[model samples]
Target: MRILGLVFAGTSTPDRSQMADFLGDTLGLPRVEVGGVEADLFELPDGSTFAVASPGGMGAPRSVGFLVDDLDAAAADLREAGVEVGPIGENERERYLHFRAPDRELYELTERKAGIA
Candidate 1:
């Protein structure tokens, strides 16, 4: 089966409010709620959709996954912003780093390999 997109980043309502600020104020993504869950409904220019969910310990949401053009550069930028970035994991198609926000939800950043297309 083919996957079109993903919804990630599960947190409590209060924490989700803070995350919404970071995503909206810091990252500049529009905030939206779906099915009663508040989210930073991220829409990339390439038409990719990613979501952050505020669940009251009910839904089974996965960790947030972000696609970056450069893994090292992105990690460095996040580090400069004082974000805690984890070690990167590499595969044939991409490299990824995991990081935790103040709300403690994990987020992943991925860099697809060169010439993937």
Candidate 2:
């Protein structure tokens, strides 16, 4: 599977343009827009896109969310591959299933709705 982006848990939703400018001017990185979400798509000279978003609000930083292409298929594949799947929260809009990597980092597979911008 292709990694669309890397989600970071930030304290607040910082000014998108300002952040983009800082990355472009100071860090010399390229920015890209994904579904109206402004992100420093190329930072650290690496190909990974950095997706910054505030979790729950200003002070509730939680987990990183990965936007996946196929929610159900990914979740099923994980389960069939012998991974433990977490409960799916329907009201959360996106379909999610969580699993822990060998390093104990919590990884979530999420399939977001299209045109959610």
Candidate 3:
């Protein structure tokens, strides 16, 4: 399946309060929560979204995320092609997975949870 678009730049920060200030108070991006993850998400003029999520790691470089049509199918395809794929994580409203590229860049793929609007 084709990627829908770049979804987010996720970072692993020990604490997000200051990061929140930087992203919201400084950068002026609105903060919102989706599927239990608190993040700053806003739509660009071109209709693409920019999001930032907090993690437990400190001062790490951000990771890239993408909106995919089908998380399960895509993982299966990647596994079949001998790629190192992560297990899909699901919550009540979201399904996502993380994996590394040939160059070792971090990436995450996500989709709306089944039965979710």
Q: What is the lDDT of every predicted structure here?
A: 0.61, 0.53, 0.68
* Candidates by lDDT, descending order: 3, 1, 2
**lDDT of predicted model 3:** 0.68
- Per-residue lDDT for 26-116 in model 3, tens only? 8777665555555555545543445555673312356777878898888987788888987787755568888887988778787865674
Q: How high is the lDDT of residue 62 in model 3?
A: 69
Point out where model 2 deviates above 4 Å. Answer: 7-62, 91-93
Give candidate 1 misplaced runs (Cα > 4 Å).
Answer: 1-61
Best by TM-score: 3
Order the numbered candidates by TM-score, best leading: 3, 1, 2
Among residues 3 or more apart in sequence or in different chains, the pairs in candidate 3 whose N, CA or C atoms overlap within 3 Å are none
Which residue pairs in candidate 1 have backbone atoms (N, alpha carbon, C) closer than 3 angstroms, thus clashing? none
RMSD vs true structure, all candidates: 11.1, 6.8, 3.4
lDDT of 1: 0.61
Error of 2 at 15 (Å): 22
Please write out the lDDT profile of model 1 over residues 1-117, one tens digit for every residue. Answer: 122243233444546667767777898766544333245565545544445556743233456666676778889888998998899876564576788879887777766668752
